[model samples]
Target: MCRLAMKTASKPFSPFSVLEAMEAMQEGYDGSGLGLLLRGLEFAEYKYNAKDPILSGIAHSEAALARLNKIMIEAGFELKYDHEFDVKRQMIEAKDRFKYILRVYKQSATWASLSAEEVENRLMLTRLALRKDGEAHGQDLTVFSLWPDVAMIKEVGWPLGVGQALGLDSGRITSRICMAQGRQNTNYGINLYACHPFFIQGVATMTNGENTAFIPIKDWLSGRGFPGYIGYQSDSEVFAHILHYVTKQLKLPLETYKHVITPLKNEELAAHPQGDFLRGLRDACRRLIIDGPNAVIGTLPDETSMLVMDAKKMRPATVGGKPGEWAIASEMCGVDAMIPDRDRSKDFQPMREHTVIIPPDRQELQIWSQFDHLPIHQAA
Candidate 1:
């Protein structure tokens, strides 16, 4: 019922380690689903070349792949390269097997000068089009994410099988950041989209607990006029979107996300010197407030990994590792599984009052607290 994310140095390491960590925490989650998100992929053949859009998801059949490609071509995107992942290792049975795997598309010469925002818009629309077409034609098309340097793999089964199907080995697959979730089936049906490590644009997130404030949060986000906000397959997906909304759209610093979603009470805010700013932030983004025992693990656009918990600290989270490498998980055992030789004495969990931030390729952890004398944005 929880989610875990591992952010390492820029160097690529096999996702096998992530799978191992997930396995160590298997008792905490059901075998319903396993979701993987990889950044700084080491699979040279499918390695990201530029800001080109890399689309990851499932296709029902070869015909569905054709339809997806046609939709992209008609929209003016040219296929610079297409590489389907080797699913020879897919050992588990499921309602649907993935066909027509990962594809990376380059912008056509005509649209070569397009801005990153334009490319993102095109990617979102193309995904939406594919989903719509899938519905109309009875095809199953699920797009996990479309962005640079990131790819997602998800399946409805145990972590071991999902990892095997991915053919993950130190030699075969590697990434700087890999997030995997072993589903426990708390709120929704076992659907592909409901899997953890939900992603949008370049940001990704996975959660270990429920967001009791899901309904209002969903309503508030859906009204934002962004087509990408339409789907809420997993209630926890809102954490990812909220990260996107606050950091991307609201033009706020990353630490502000912790403040908006789990703001302190008025009395607690009064303890800070910049209480006025904190109060204004709470009032402005009140609709985005999240309630209950939730722990969120996510990556920012800059590739920094974040860990935060709600005020109640209902779920377990441990942060540990040496410099240039760090991991945040729902349990200390998961961290121990990944870095068994690390100093366990130094291992620490973020108190409900602090948010943990790990920068890419570095281990200078920053702790942002609500009771700090500085404003929330300046707390980090």
Candidate 2:
């Protein structure tokens, strides 16, 4: 599907209506909410314009929070503080729910008000609990037999088709091909395929991001010898290209295999050979290609399908058949960090780059909630 045009400041942003304002009040960080807060803070005479207004707006903020809580409660929430509930707690809750308004308003207002360094510094300070990580996924990976006989691949004209198939821009799709492969960010998804079908002897390391066809070659395959495409770093391009045909285009059955695994000392190596290892590696990729999409059902989907639950079907947060209200943390990651014995990230792989976060629902009201609760102590 074509992506919606992202709102930019160069063109006039349409003025938001009352309905938009009400929705922003509910969501906390919508365009209207940002507009309201931007006009409020940008025109403020207060020294710490950001914080002071929240205290000034607290009465309205409290009313908003009360309504949200009441909805949650009527929806069947058993509200109580886990530790102790202070009035400050409500302010913090509302502030957090709508923190993005502050961010969007900042952007809409301008960097002219802030130093370059201050802008950079503000990112970390503002979103304390946001989890920063990176993830990768793919669609319709297919493979073919290249074990004994080498397979030949043909480069088809500009893979705009591939881009559409995988939900990416045609321009981005075009840049990847026939260019120096670079990283959009280490966090981006990449795609690579064969320029020409040639001999396949060893592992293929394909890449896509800054470029369409560069792969990183490590000396791990020393004995494999200098093979085809002497200019490329890794053979992943060849491999992934082959996979595109075998798994996606042809839907061929592939013999999945692993190329290498450690712990193959005299003891472990005694049971397995080099060929067995490669097969294991291939099988692993195949399984992931098959299962990854299903796993992201609740997290992300290629297509957005709003499962509008019947108003009566959805219930408030519950436990043991009791209505239990939930406290969403500073961010989704924070909530994830709260599960029992959940030192979830301690041993987990740190992302090579920061992860991106997008919310499913409009959150402007949540941001407005924060403005309502900005603390007097934080007042400048």
Give lDDT: candidate 1, residue 189. 68
Q: What clash pairs does model 1 have? A: 2-208
Best-performing candidate as measured by TM-score? 1
Candidate 1 lDDT over 224-321, as tens digits, reads: 89888877877898999999888778777777888899888888888767778888889989999998688888886567988888888888889888
Candidate 2 lDDT over 191-276, as tens digits, reads: 22222111122112212112222222223222234232222222333333333233233333222111111112344333443434
Model 1 whole-model lDDT (C-alpha atoms): 0.77
Question: Per-residue lDDT for 99 in model 1?
Answer: 76
After aligning candidate 1 to the native by TM-score, how far in Å is the CA of 275 from where it should be? 1.3
Q: TM-scores of the models, in the given order? A: 0.93, 0.17
- For candidate 1, the per-residue lDDT at 339 reads 72
In order, candidate lDDTs are 0.77, 0.20
